[model samples]
Every structure is written in C-alpha cells, then in structure tokens.
Target: MEESKPVSYYIPNPDDDPTNERITRITNKIKIEDLIERSKRIKGCKVFQLEGRFVNLFNEAYQAYILGMDYTTVSLCALASERLCYDLIESSKITFDGRIISNIEKESFYRIPFSELVFFSKSIGLLPDKVAGKMMKLNNMRNVYIHPSFKRDRSDPEKLQIKPESDSVTALNNLIDIISGFGK
Candidate 1:
C-alpha cells in the first residue's frame, strides 16, 4: 500500500463545529428515519393545484422546511404569494389590482408593494378576505426576519419568538391553506 498524506484535503479548524460539516458523515444531524417520517407529512397532505412557477416555489418551500432551512422556507412562501399577485396583474386588465392599467407611466403600475398586493387582491374578487389576511401575516413574518428593524430597542415582539422553525412551518401551512381554499 502506498502512503498518502492528502495535504490538500480540508483540515478542520479548532474553532469550527464539526457537526456543521461532514457531508460524507451524515450522522449526528437529522436522522434518516426521522427525516423520512417528516417528509411523509408532506406526501400525505392534500395536493393543491398551482401554476408552473408556483409549483417550483411550493416544492422548494417544502424541501427547505424539511431540511430545517426555516428562513428560506418562509421567504419562498412570501415569494409565491407575491408571484400570485403579479400574475393577476399580468392577466387582468386592472392595475394594482384596482387602478386602470395604461401603456404610459409604466413605473407606477410596476411598483406595487406586497401589502398592497395582499390587500387589493382581497379588495377585488381575486382572493378571499381570510386568504388575503393570511398572506399579509405571512409577509409580515418574512419581513421580520428578511428585513430586521434597527430601532436599537427591545419593543419588537417578534424578536422574542425563538427559532425560525415555527414561523417557517406556519408560513408553509398558511400558504397551502390559501391555495386549497381558492376554489371554495
């Protein structure tokens, strides 16, 4: 047998957490059986009809939640909702879900905010009131993490909520519920 030093291979630093790496050593993290069971929850859920782009976003959101990438999951859900509103803009004649869409001064029409999207979506017949409210709540959850407020104070109630897992799960479930309720 020839001797090999393999000096180019990664040498772990003392300060680094070994559990953070070790892709080849997949143990000590999420157990395979547990992950399988967790994934089964998704497999068992009621399937909702989604558009092409939404399908990708929905799938990725589930995968992120399963993999414990909570922030990513929450963000994806928000993006999906935003995309839904954007699609309505593209298909319907109304602008900002209410304003009359015109050819000129395109910037104003294109600059719809997320809050407006959710609110106006409900204001019109597009989204149900409950679904629109839930979307707004989900957007708020995403904003708390994605856009941290730097007030230099401790008044923010969301800061007290430990871990992103709960928020991510909530966002994912709310999104699914909204889509499921679309028909009825």
Candidate 2:
C-alpha cells in the first residue's frame, strides 16, 4: 500500500506559527541535556546504561519532528517508548519482585504490541494515571502509521498535513518526565 505523504515536505506552512520551531529547538536541547546529566548520576542503572540506545531513538524522533516528518516522528516516538517500557518492566521486576524477568519473557512481551505495553504499564502503576492515558493516546496516534487498518482518510493527499511541531516537543517532554528521575 502506498503511504500517505504529508502535504508539504520540509516546507513551512504559512498558516502555522514559525516561532514554535525556535522555542522547540531551545527547549529540546535543554531537556536532552537535563536528561543526559540526570542519567549520568545513575551509572549502574539499566535505564542509564542503556540510555545510548533508546535515548538516541528518542532524540532521532525529536529530530524528525523538527524536520516536519510527522509520521516518521510518531513512529520513532512509539519505538522509543516501547524500548523504555521493556527496560522499566525488567528493572522493576528485578528491583521490586526480587527476580530477573527472563529474556524469553521480555521478548514475548515486546512482541505483544504497543497498546498492551501502555495497559501493562498502567496496571502496574509504572506511570501515573494521566501520563498513562497520554501514553495510550500516543500509542493510538502511532498505530495510524504502523497498522494499515487504523489509517483512515488517506485519500486526501493534500489534507495529509504534518502534525504541528509542538506536538513532538510536548511528547518528548513527557517522555523525559517519565524516565528522567529513574534510580534517582
């Protein structure tokens, strides 16, 4: 199936406020730096040790958002969240339950799909209720790109506008808030 492309590729839409990018750029750098510094303190933590992996994924998603690639941004955002979920679940099991979640179980859980991760995280109280709901919304938004069946109104190519850049900024902020204080 042909993917629906954004109406404008890397072009500024006059109808949208351009100042948002400037604000996002400044805040994005600050948040990333804050996360890096925060992660540095927990040198032994799994989330800290693996920061290079999924954190980079999150950064790439942020970059995609800045470049106006909404679909790619959302897709990568979901992937980064999924990776974080796996890490958090394993870490929590080890810390709270006094057992290592086996690689087999981890792999099986990872394969179960994104929405389930949100539900599982919520059920375990890994995230606060409001954040979990936002994560669910993000997962649902992501499914529009990943699952063909979830996509609707693909016929209007011109109407396939890129999501406002602020949405990506907000998502990244939420992600940082979710994992920033781990092992703190």
Candidate 3:
C-alpha cells in the first residue's frame, strides 16, 4: 500500500502579533490609497505585458503567412501563455494534473504548467467547458511563445495576424472582485 501524504496546515504565529514592531517593520507603512494604487499598477503592468506578447504573436503569424511559412504554432502558443498568466493571476493559484495548488515556489509562479492549471480551473468552478473554450484559444497561443523554435523567429519581419475579441479582460476583472471579498 502507498503511504498517505500528511495534510498541510497554516497556523498563525502566537508571537507574531500585528502590534509587534518586527511585523510592523515588514508590513506596508503607506496609506490605503497608495496600496490600492500600487496593486492597480502591478495589475496594469501584467496586462500590458500580456498585450505586448499577443501583439508579437499576431505580428509573427502575419509575417509567416506572408512568407508562406508555418508560424501558426508559435503565434498560437504566445497567445496561450499570455492567457494562462492572466488566469493564474486571477485565480491566485496554480493547477496541475487535476490538483489545485496554492503554494508553488516563489520563482516559478509565472511558469505554471497548463495541465495543472486547467484541472484546477475546472475543479474550482472558475472555468467550465464553455468558458474553457475561450481559455484554450489563449493557452494554445502561450505554448507557441514558450517553445524555443518560435522564439527564434520572433524578430523576423513576418507578422502574425491575431485580434483580441474576447471578454477575457472582463473576466479577469472579476478576480479583483473575488479577492476583495476576502476582506469582507
């Protein structure tokens, strides 16, 4: 028989009270408005980066089409990565192999595996088959961006033609709403 894994738990530290000086030192000293602004700024940056990648994919596909090259794979993958990143940020967790993960390594947040993400998304009611169709389109684009072969041809003058026509941005906005719910 296989050994069962122990359940993990997060307990608050008795010695680490909010009034502690050490805790205060590490915590934000800024106003609430400043924190909100910062959060918005970070979110905006992520969205901007995603858009830039999408643009690159579209441009690459266009160029490839013009040159009669098969660039669909690369272009599609880039768009997928962008969408995956957006989903990851919205969910605040990474999924893999049917497992919903919340405590991934700090550095690997952006490199979450798609299979896991898809599984978790389905499990959490955050992504259903109908919505997943839209997500799949984005995920396909991400695969192309991460693959090395596609990266090499990014600088080529050939352009890919992809347009943003979905409600992904609105969907992502809902994440902010979900996160805000935690404070209630």
* TM-scores, all models, native as reference: 0.69, 0.54, 0.29
Put down candidate 2 lDDT per residue, 1-184, tens digits, no spaces.
4544676325556776767775556446555555554344322313445633677887787666655555676777767777777766655653236777665666666677667777877787776666566566567667765675664466775454335354455555555555554433
Q: What is model 3's C-alpha RMSD? A: 19.5
**Each candidate: what lDDT?**
0.70, 0.61, 0.43
RMSD of each: 9.8, 11.2, 19.5
Report how far off residue 72 is in candidate 2 (Å): 1.8
Q: Please give, for residues 1-184, the per-residue lDDT of candidate 3 as tens digits.
A: 1134897544448866677665665444435564454334212212233233444643443343333233343344335444544544554655567876555452354565765665555576655554454455445544444443443245663443222221223222332233332333
Top lDDT model: 1
The stretch of ten residues in a row with the least summed lDDT in candidate 2 is: 38-47
Model 1 agreement with the true structure over 9-95: per-residue lDDT tens digits: 555678868666663454466777866765655423476664447678878898888887788988999888777666555656665
- Report the CA-based lDDT of candidate 2 relative to the real structure: 0.61
Once fitted onto the true fold, the runs of candidate 1 whose alpha carbons sit more than 4 angstroms away are: 1-21, 26-30, 40-45, 93-109, 150-159
* Model 2 steric clash pairs: none
What's the TM for model 3? 0.29
Clashing pairs in 1: none
